[model samples]
Target: MRYESIVRNTEFSRAYRRGKSYVSPFLVTYVLRRKRGGVRLGITTSKKIGGAVQRVRARRVIREAYYAMGLNEEQSVDLVFVARTATTRVKMQKVEKAMRAHLTAAGLLSR
Candidate 1:
């Protein structure tokens, strides 16, 4: 599914930093907030995740996992996904699993 438009605005990025509520595990860290159509997912992977290839893979895994879960509701929500160092050693399935696990824990997944 296509996600909503997300721009690199200082406000949105800062809001995430200021937000107290967040979900973090050994694999990823995420923050969710209500926005206006579907959820907009933003991913962050530092240089610590290895090189650009590994970072891109991590991002693709998370995005694909989100798509697979079928959370394409009209309710607007912003999700920021941060990759942890451990993500470098894990496979795509594990990355997807972590994404699903975090989303479920956040009550973003009900079905």
Candidate 2:
């Protein structure tokens, strides 16, 4: 199932305040359980990652990695993926792997 985007500032803040986080070299992931059905995804790339081009690239890579995971639509969760500076240079596979690892650890992945 296609996941929805978490687009509001409040949504991001909610995830930050209530979520469990996992960090890797390329990404920091926050996962929060939601009462709503289906998953919502949010991605952020800070200035520390680089200039606009680099930051946008980081967001693109993170979004791609998340789409590759094929998460179940039946699950209810809010996921925020924050890009690290290292993310600008990492391959998509590495990003995807890091995401999968975190989701698995969080018990969001069914296996």
Which prediction has the highest lDDT against the true structure?
Answer: 2
**Clashes within 3 Å, all models in order:** 0, 0
The TM-score leader among the candidates is 2
Candidate 2 residue-wise lDDT, 1-81, digit = tens: 577899999999999999999999899999999887889999998899999999999999998888888887888999999
TM-score of each: 0.76, 0.95
User: The CA-based lDDT of model 1 is what?
Assistant: 0.67
Give the residue spans of candidate 1 off by over 4 A.
9-12, 18-26
- Measured with C-alpha atoms, the lDDT of residue 8 in candidate 1 is 80
CA lDDT scores, all candidates in order? 0.67, 0.92
Question: Weakest 10 consecutive residues, lDDT, candidate 1?
Answer: 19-28
Residue-wise lDDT of candidate 1 within 44-80, one digit each (tens)? 7789888999888777776776677777477657777
